[model samples]
Target: MNAGNTFEVEVRGIRREAETVRSFELWPLGAESAESAESGEAYELPPFEPGAHLDVHVPGDLVRQYSLTNPHERHRYVIGVNRDPASRGGSIRMHDAVTVGSRLTVSAPRNHFPLNEAAVHSVLVAGGIGITPLLAMVRRLCELGRSWDLYYCARTESRAAFLRELRELADTCPDGALHCVFDGVPGTAPLDIRAVLAKHGAQADFYCCGPTPLMDAFTAALADVPPERVHLEYFKAPEISTPANSQAFTVTLARQQKSFVIEPDRSILHVLQEHGVAVMCSCREGVCGTCETAVLAGEPDHRDRVLSPEERAANRTMMICVSRCKGDALTLDI
Candidate 1:
């Protein structure tokens, strides 16, 4: 990791990976550069794992996240971003305001979807821009000489980022295992996730990141596989309609000897923060694991994407941002 939890970096390069996707290369500021403010001197970035991501501070006080596509590049972190029309000024602002020499403050790498090093085989699946983190994992697996294959899908060939690089990597492996599926290509068959997943044994480690529908299909396809062995990273939280049976509940902070009542309209995190409780949070929809809190004594309504079905059943922790107490009163360690 970096020496500090956060640092400032200058954008050094921008490369178009596809029609809408562009890669940003960040060069971390060094001592001399900090003093000069324009010097070319920069320090080697800290090491990051295959699935790690950095929280980037964009122009509108927005802390949007982007996955690091390359971990072995010592001097810079390369992240890909698609110019999303529906973005809340994050990706759009990055595309418009950021260029070579644009300075930005960023958090150190953090990973929730990590690669399992000891697996007998690995299956990497990606959809559109979701290929960023999986590309990093593919690079790591190739470096270790591990057996792995990637199934990448996009709406069209022009929108598929890193195709050339992935093709080259698969070329190094036997039988060229990179599978690309493009829906817009003439006579291209729809990718049957069931057929793709069935080719691999249940013991193989499966990793997927993509649009919600695609991920749901993957989850359904892996019903026979152990849930713990299947890893997923969601760019957006799964949509769940409000439960008509939802009720107001109370949360007790065991360590602080504090209690707060959460109305059905408000989340536990909102109530706690209103009462001056400190909790770091991101993606309030619960996809990111930032607001995960220890559940010391009560059953929590688990709603986060970070936890597995088994972890949810254990009730060890819950994401306070979107989850609530299952019982009348929930006890938290903090």
Candidate 2:
């Protein structure tokens, strides 16, 4: 989707999965609605790549990133949000205050880790909420008649959001290819990543998205494979490695006409927010592109996972969450 285009949408529906998780359905407002309806509109926003994600601005000064879980042909945008009690306030606000009629601003979809071209056979592994992007990939693979398999692991069957749908899709495949591994199943064992890899490794491309521990295990277990053969998309950015004797810095928002002194222990985004500067952000770890802004003047110490090498070379956009200004004073577009 175009980076410049944005939409104002209202929550059309909300469904709670558990105490901490919820699914939200949104629709575009005003004339865009009529235009979409006329064209048999599926998504309120532009069609996105299979693994694309969007930045959602929630109430209580919260901005978060969520993967688009619905197929590209669907009429509405769907996101599954898991509330984190330890979160700064984003997830809590989303679960508590967001309702069927609540309104929010959403940025266009962004894809930093698009599917690779050499993926002849696909193997998708998902854990819990990590299934969002993989669900879209499954749909795309099915439509293309590509060889694919999905291994979905959850704490229990009831906790899996689209268990029924996944099972049906698996049944309809040319050959049975879906495997469900429940953590608490009486008879079934936990997911055996090694066994799965041993059987699927030769000609398949492995794409994994999950929690930190799961991803970490996959990384360690798959170390023998070529890096290009394995793909990963994280819901959170990698942690920053602090340097010795790092000093504080100054940041200037050229558009907003504001400036702030950011301590070494604080992130630029946190410092800006503390000063009451309105900035958009999600996935504060830096994987999501919601908090990205244009760099007007200064060298940026790029630390985010979303920007491409070319995008970074251009030095135009920067993810404010984890990225820092390299120079003593930095200017931003706000």
Regions more than 4 Å wrong, model 2: 1-5, 15-21, 30-44, 83-89, 186-189, 238-241, 245-263, 270-279, 293-301, 307-317, 325-334
lDDT of all predictions: 0.85, 0.77
TM-score of 2: 0.79
Residue 325 accuracy (lDDT) in model 1 = 75
Task: Provide the lDDT at 70 for model 2.
Answer: 71
List, residue by residue over 1-334, the lDDT tens digit for candidate 2.
2446666777887887544567888776542454564465333357677888877888876667788877564346788887877767777888888888888988777776677544778888898888878877887777666778899888887767666667777777663378878887788777788888898889788888888777887777787877667878886755557866466778888877888887888999998888888777667787777778988998788888777667788999898888887768789987
TM-score of each: 0.89, 0.79
Question: Can you list the residue pairs that collide in candidate 2?
Answer: 42-74, 42-75
